[model samples]
Target: MLIDSHTNLHGETYAEDLDAVIERAREANVSGMIAICCRLSDFEEVSAIAERYDNIWCTIGAHPHHAKDRPDITPDELVEIARHPKVIGIGETGLDFHYGYSPREEQFRSLRAHVEAARRIDLPLILHTRDADDEMADFLESEMEQGAFRALLHCYTGGSALAKRAAKLGAYFAASGIITFKKAEDVRQVFRNDIPEDRIIIETDCPYLAPVPHRGRRNEPSYLPDVLTGVCETLGWTPDEGEAKTTEAFFRLFSKAERPS
Candidate 1:
């Protein structure tokens, strides 16, 4: 089954047609989706959507872009919120040096709290990193040494070195709509060569990186098949093989989510 492993179904993007967007995704054969939360302030909206649907589950924790807004947030607070039945994962958190929307130190502080929460809760840490592969790689390696926690580098676009290192640490990698771009061969290469085959999954990062043929348009979970097609082409797998492999990896990482009967 197809699962959109990362999404931003909350907020203004989906406000007008949230129901239509979800129905379209279901029509596209998407079996489930993990609605990702990037801000504590946005958790109400995020979790509300998850609660509204049987096939949707949500994650908690802040994105690094807003790290400065809540730098001192502790693992206890995250673990507390994560007790909600629909809150099955611990972040869309990690460093995003490209935007520098938040300072590096604040990002580090917030990410550490998320890691600890994931470790404490036994939930997968959903990470987003851009233009700071070395810092992210180093941070993940060091924290993992402190203790083990599951992680998925959602919408991965980093260099191969980080993928290689993180793979050895059992971190999963997500290929997003980015893989369908003309200039994203590097990303596709990581899917095919760097990340362990069993650890590769897929996402739309919707309202953002919509795949090709629909690039530049707003993304939604309904567009995930294009991303899956791109991944299949990259890995030299047929559509059926890609579907089974990526879906398997997704369920494995987001273990708290149950596949619908």
Candidate 2:
């Protein structure tokens, strides 16, 4: 069975037909989904969705885009939200220099808080990075030296240099729909050569980068197989092998997310 390691099920786009979305994902052979909480404000809804579905899990954190609003958000606050068993990870947080939605300083501060919280709780730290590969590499190396923390770089599109460094730190990497793009050779290359086979995982990052064949359409967990197709192609593995390995990697990284019965 396949698992979508990242999904924004709480996004407004899914409000009208969430039940249908879940059913379709099930029909697509998707056994589990981690409904990512991108904004601190959405944790309530994200948590409730995780609670309502036996196969669905959720994470807690503020995206770097909202760093300015909560520049002082602390690990204590993140740990408090993570008290629920459904909360399996510490963030969808990191630097997003591509958008510059928040000052670089605020973004750095926000990421440190998440890093500390994940270290304290021994849960994986969900990360997002864009257009700041060098900075991200530097920060992760420094923070890892301070203390090791499990980390997953979701929708990774950074340079291979960063991928190489992250892999050395034992960070996991998630491949999103972007891998299916015709012009994403660099991203596909990283998957092919840089990341360790066991460290690779899959995600939809829905309401966003829908895989090819479903391009320009609203993304959902059901489209994960399409993304898996890209993974199989890049990794030179058959469908069965791709599913088993990625599903294995997903469970290994997100160990707190109990398998669906």
In model 2, which range of ten residues has the least summed lDDT? 252-261
Model 1 regions lying over 4 Å from their true place: none
Minimal lDDT window, size 10, model 1: 186-195
Q: Write the per-residue lDDT of candidate 1 for residues 1-261, one digit (tens) a residue.
A: 799999998888889999999999999989899999999998998999999998899999899999999977999999999999998899989999988999999999999999999999999999988899998899989998999999899899988999999999999999988899999988888777888988989999998999998998999999999999999989898999999999999889989999977
TM-score, per-candidate, Cα-based: 0.98, 0.99
Model 2 quality (TM-score): 0.99
Model 2 RMSD in angstroms = 0.7
Which lDDT tens digits does candidate 2 get at residues 1-261? Answer: 999999999967989999999999999999999989888989999999999987899999989999898988999999988988999998899999988999999999999999999999899999999888999999999999999999999998888899999999999999999999999999999888899999989999998999999999999999999999999999999999999999999999999988877
Flag regions of model 2 displaced more than 4 Å. Answer: none
Q: How many backbone clashes does candidate 1 have?
A: 0
Write down the TM-score for model 1.
0.98
